[model samples]
Target: MGKTLAEKVWDEHVVRSTEGEPDLLFIDLHLIHEGTSPQAFDGLRLAGRKVRRPDLTLATEDHNVPTLDWDKPIADPVSKTQVDTLRKNAAEFGVRLHPLGDIEQGIVHVVGPQLGLTQPGMTIVCGDSHTSTHGAFGSIAFGIGTSEVEHVLATQTLPQAKPKTMAVTVNGSLPEGVTAKDLVLTLIAHTGTGGGQGYIVEYRGQAIRELSMEGRMTVCNMSIEWGAKAGMIAPDETTFAYIEGKPEAPKGADWDAAVEHWRTLVTDDDATFDKEIVLDASTMTPFVTWGTNPGQGVALGANVPSPEDFSDPSDKLACENALDYMGLEAGQPMRSVKVDTVFVGSCTNGRIEDLRLAAEIIKGHKVAEGTRLLVVPGSVRVRLQAMEEGLDQVFIEAGAEWRGAGCSMCLGMNPDTLQPQERSASTSNRNFEGRQGKGGRTHLVSVPVAAATAVRGTLSSPADLVPAGV
Candidate 1:
């Protein structure tokens, strides 16, 4: 009968509740991007309504901005128009805007946490599906549609039917080469793409507790890919430490008080979930998606699944379609699968920790012939920090192109895209057909795998780069 973390956060944010109708939940923070805010802003104009709480709203240019040129006019007219409209709208609406070239400008999800705007026990919504990234702090964060965007902008609240809760307990220690990315991919493979439908998953247990805040963010970031409304991990010491000195975080006496409250934002001992599942992290291996969807993945050493491997007719057909589109075959080995590019950045894996991991593996090595490597930071702050620590030089010297911060090569919304049929190993979340570019093939990977793949010109891992033994 106890409350789960999601339930607790939801109940606290309810502005109004009515029987047989959705509750109007107060939105603590609203994140907007160029891709989804244009229409919402127009809606506000038509209604002659102003943003109800401009202080609680923020906007950034990511989806449509070019990552390479900081000052050049966006070449694509559609992309340029979108970016321009957001700036004009933000200014007119009095919402804080982080345009390209601003130190804070980056992926909305990345900007939120980097600035300490994402906190525990608060409700956050964005137009991007990866908004669940903020739930790493035990917040009730999820993506909203364009209409909902306008609703939140006008009222600072959202109407919602509460989702069922699911507890995903990851126990045991991860192996040396495994990472949060691998863990999440493995989870998707186990649960299938629709496993978390109509639920907000709360990741728990020993292994989840042991991950860093960055690692936890990576997990929660991909919750949507598995059909979950949101994903979260309870706030703990690690979460507090990460937020301690952040620019938007509380300071001095306020910091202490905030932590005291965040500490209480956990599931009660007897809290019951609509469903529960357990995963043993120690048994996991480096994982990658072979098919178009995230769930069609196997371990790094496993073979591509044949269509017949699926017992269900629909699953079998889906497998066949994915294999054809991916230009892969049944029983094909995942290791050494050739790639044209290796992209090391995204909301899911574009933070400083992710950059450093890729840099460490890429140091003293060069990208393989005919393979292009791109190291894009998640935010301008992360980019500056990476440069301060000389991570840029490490990547540049290793033949990786060091670029400005943005959601490059993540969704192919900008110039950072793949040529037709070009294959890539990327750290981004989705890998659906044409997700990276028209006719492009993407294999979702971790930083280590992405870096190693660049050097070997194939889907690989750190262990593949290292000699069998010293």
Candidate 2:
């Protein structure tokens, strides 16, 4: 049988197999962040063990750092301690760390790929749930809990059972204004957030092949939302081009040899997946979440679904609860919803490309008078690049609060948060109840939609804010 990309990468990284047990796979990269690594490091200390391969691990402070001030001390005691603990742990374990104010500091997922540490065919593990973001490079990456984090730190290997494989083939060309965020949200809606259970999904077909590396990352980053163990795309020219000049990428002859190996990473013509799904990208549009879960989404032009529309009893109950939590009226046009805040930053959509897209729409406009708008970069590197292109100026001139890099507003770990009873149009992933703050309601949208919402103080699309031409 022809092997899928996930199988090929898994086979190459397997160190040993035990009778009647899962293989002990070797991990090439271990990523750590402030939210989950403190306890893992404590476990290692109590056991009197040191990191087996510090060279293979990297650490950064995100999730708990204030985005508004890079130099001031963290105001939240719990958040401050988390960041302090990570720094102490990294120093004691001889692992390199990008502190809060460092130029390389940002979301762990964003920093890994930008630094060239996430390579094709490598096994990557992180303490963050969104670690699957690295799969864009054809790597087998997944999230690990704190216990698993300590296991990898002590042994440099993980005992994991192989997962079933599924193929999600998106064919045809994506329409204008449709983005990776829309594509992923649509997939979750189709798959019901539990369709990929017990499987690693491989994204294929012409539409996926045409996506840039960053876009691919955006797709794979949300695999977990669909119950997939991981999601990956085969490495190709787009992947190679993105990694060419990265700090950790191969050089000279090594680069040439690596490309040759990556060329053979694709699934064979006859390869079989445990399951397959096909989607037409041209039919997709800007998607937004109307309910608490990512799967509860509709196209921008559609109305919020009434509970009666759900045929299944369970689904009907879920819809009722979601509507109550979100304070949304059934059958109402989603575009007419008002928002108190607008956030555009997270591991999922805080890249330079995402910032550029949002900036393009907000260039000559100002944010709504009563709305709070925050524009955060994904990493220090992204922040610097955006400044070089004057994107920072454009955002600042639009009356948006230009902030430092971190996982701000993606979750409530940091100081950036929505007040109680506040509704927000956010570009970040996940819209679960209380995700932003207690009693805060979130609606997920694309970068352009987020920008437009900032301008109008409502859930609006870019088409409504900007004309077709400039």
Candidate 3:
């Protein structure tokens, strides 16, 4: 039988395979950050082993790094220690380190692709769940536990059972106001949170092909949120164009050779996936999570659904709890929901392209008086690029806060967090309870939706921002 993309990538990286034993696959790139590497480094210290391939390993300060005045000492000792420990370990172990002040410093997932370290036909692992973001380049990328991190540090190989392959084909074209984020949210809602379990999902068909590299990354970035082992997108001309001139990308003949290999990485024509799902993109609308979980979402035109609307006992219970926590009522129009914070940044949507879209959509529009709009770039490089384009000024003039690069407001790790009972229309992945902070409610949204929500101070579709009859 012809092979799927996941199988092809897995088979190419096998170092050892035994009957009754998990295959040992060599990892091409191992990305690490402050929060998750300390213990892994400690494991290395106790074993007195150096990083087997420091050249292939990259580390940076994120999670706890402040988006504002990052150069200043971190106020939280635990956060400071994690950053300090990572720096000490990276320097001691001779690994390439990008600290807060470094131009290359930023979220690991964002930095990898931006710097060209993430590429097609590679096996990548990070100590972060969103590492699947790198899979946008057609690589087999996934997250590892701390011990797994240590194992990769020492051996650069991981033992893994093969996951089944699944295909999510979105036919036709997405509606004007819909985004890659909306498409992925619709997928999760179709399959629920555990829908992709034990599978490596390949996003294909017309709508996916129409997406730019940035849009592809946004879809793959949230794969983990749907319980997928990882996500994969077949490398194509668009992928090559995005990586061709990056700092770590190959030059001249090397580049040509790399592209040749990547071209062969797609799933075979006769390949059959273990599971399949098909959707009509034209029917998908911008999604907003009325409940805490991402799967508990509905269309922009949808109303808040009652728990009793669900058939499954677990889903019904979850819906009830989510509604109570989010302070929402059934039968209420989603557009009527108000928000105090509108965050535009995360590994999912903090890229340069995302920033540009949000800035363009929100230009000349004042943020609502009671709303706080925070626009943060994914990396220092993205931050500098935005400033050069004066996107920062556009946001500032519109009453939004132009912040530095980091995973701000995506979770409670950094200083940019929502307070008790505070609700936000966020571009970040995950809307779990306290994902932003204790007693905080989150509604996952696309960049354009978050941009419009900031101006309206309510959950809104991007279409609502347009002047009528335009």
Candidate 4:
């Protein structure tokens, strides 16, 4: 049997295997954040152990830092303490630290790729669930718990049972108005939330091959929501191009050698997967989640699903509960559903390219009356790039609030959150119940879809709002 891309990468990273026990795998990189690293650092201290490979570890303050007022003290004491502790720990452990407002500071996942720390055939672990975002580079990246973080700090390796492999082959080109976000949401709707359980998915086929590195990142970023241990696309020309000039990427002769190795990272012609799924991209449209879970999605032009449509009693009950919490009517057109807010930022779609796409659509369009819109950058570097391109002006002129870089409103960990009963069209991943805030309804959509929703104050697609040329 031929090995899939996941299997190839896993086999290469395995350090040792014992019968009836999990294999000990070497982790190439360990990413840390303020939200989860505090206790792990403390554990290492109490155990009198030093980080085994400080050079391979990195830290940043994101989840708890305020987006505004970079120079001021963090207003929330708990948040301040966490951020402070991370800095102290990083210094004590001899790991590189990107503190709040630092040019390199941002969401850990975003920072990894932007800095070229995420590369093909490597094993990356972070404390954030969206660590799968790094898998876009053809690496095996996944989230780890606090204890696991401590373990990695002390050992620079992880013990793991091998996961099954699944292939999500997206064929054909996507429609004009569809996006990576829509494609992922559509897949979730088809496979349900638990479809990829105990599996590391390898996205393949023509459509997957056509995606940009950022687009691939967006697709893999939500794999956890589908219950996948990790999700990845094989390295190709596009991946190489994106990493070519990155600071940490190989240069000169080393660059040529690295690309040569990355070239062979693709699945072989006869590679076999444990499971396979095929999706047609052309038929997909702008999609949104109407319920708490990421799987409860429908096309923008479609109607909300009724619980009775589900044949399984469990599915029916789940749909009913989701509908009740979302306050959405069954069979009601999603386009006509009003929104209270629009948020455009997160590891899933908070890059410079994402902001540019939304800004292009929002150039002359105004946010609907009474709608609160926020445009946050994923990191300080992304924010600087967006400003240089005047994306901030375009958003501010369109009546959207432009804020600093951080994981804002994505998990409600910061002050940026929705008020009770406030419904929002957000570009961030995850639409779990009260994810944005207590009693806050969330509808996950693409950047363009989010831009159009802000213009119309309802769930909408950019094609419906913008003209043919302008």
Q: Judging by lDDT against the true structure, name the best candidate.
A: 1
- Once fitted onto the true fold, the runs of candidate 4 whose alpha carbons sit more than 4 angstroms away are 466-470
User: Residue 147's C-alpha lDDT in candidate 1?
Assistant: 97
Candidate 4, residues 355-375, lDDT tens digits: the string is 999999888889999887899
- What does candidate 2's lDDT look like per residue over 1-470, in tens digits? 78999999999988998889999999999999988888899999999999999999999998999987779999899999999999999999999999988989999999999999998988999988799899999999999999999999999999999999999999998998888899999999998878888898999988899888889999999998888999999999999999999999999999999999999998888789999999999899999999988899999899999999999999999999999989889989998899999999898899999999999998889899999889999999999999999999999999999999999899978878888879998988889899999989999998989999999898888888855235
lDDT of 1 by residue, 1-470 (tens): 89999999999999999999999999999999999989999999999999999999999998878888779899999999999999999999999999998889998988999899998989999998899999999998999999999999999999999899999999998998799999999999998899988999999998899999999999999999899999999999999999989999999999989999989899999989999999999999999999998998999989999998999999999999999999997998999489999999999999999998998888888899999999889999999999999999999988889998889899999999998899999999999999999999999998899999998998999988863223
Which rank order by lDDT, best down to worst? 1, 3, 2, 4
Taking the tens digit of each residue's C-alpha lDDT, what string does model 3 give over 1-470? 89999999999999999999999999999999998899999999999988999999999887889998877899889898898999999999999999999999998999999999999999999999999999899999999899999999999999999999999999999989799999999999888889999999999999998899999999999999889999989998899999989999999999989988999999999999999999999988888889888898998779999988999899899989999999999999999999999999999999999999998888888899999999989999999999999999999999999988888789879889889899999999999999999999999999989999998999986678865235
What's the lDDT for all of these models? Answer: 0.93, 0.92, 0.92, 0.91
Predicted structure 3, TM vs. truth: 0.99
Each model's TM-score? 0.99, 0.98, 0.99, 0.98
Backbone collisions counted per model: 0, 0, 0, 0
Give the distance in Å from residue 198's predicted Cα in candidate 3 to where it truly belongs: 0.5
**Candidate 3 overall Cα lDDT vs. reference?**
0.92
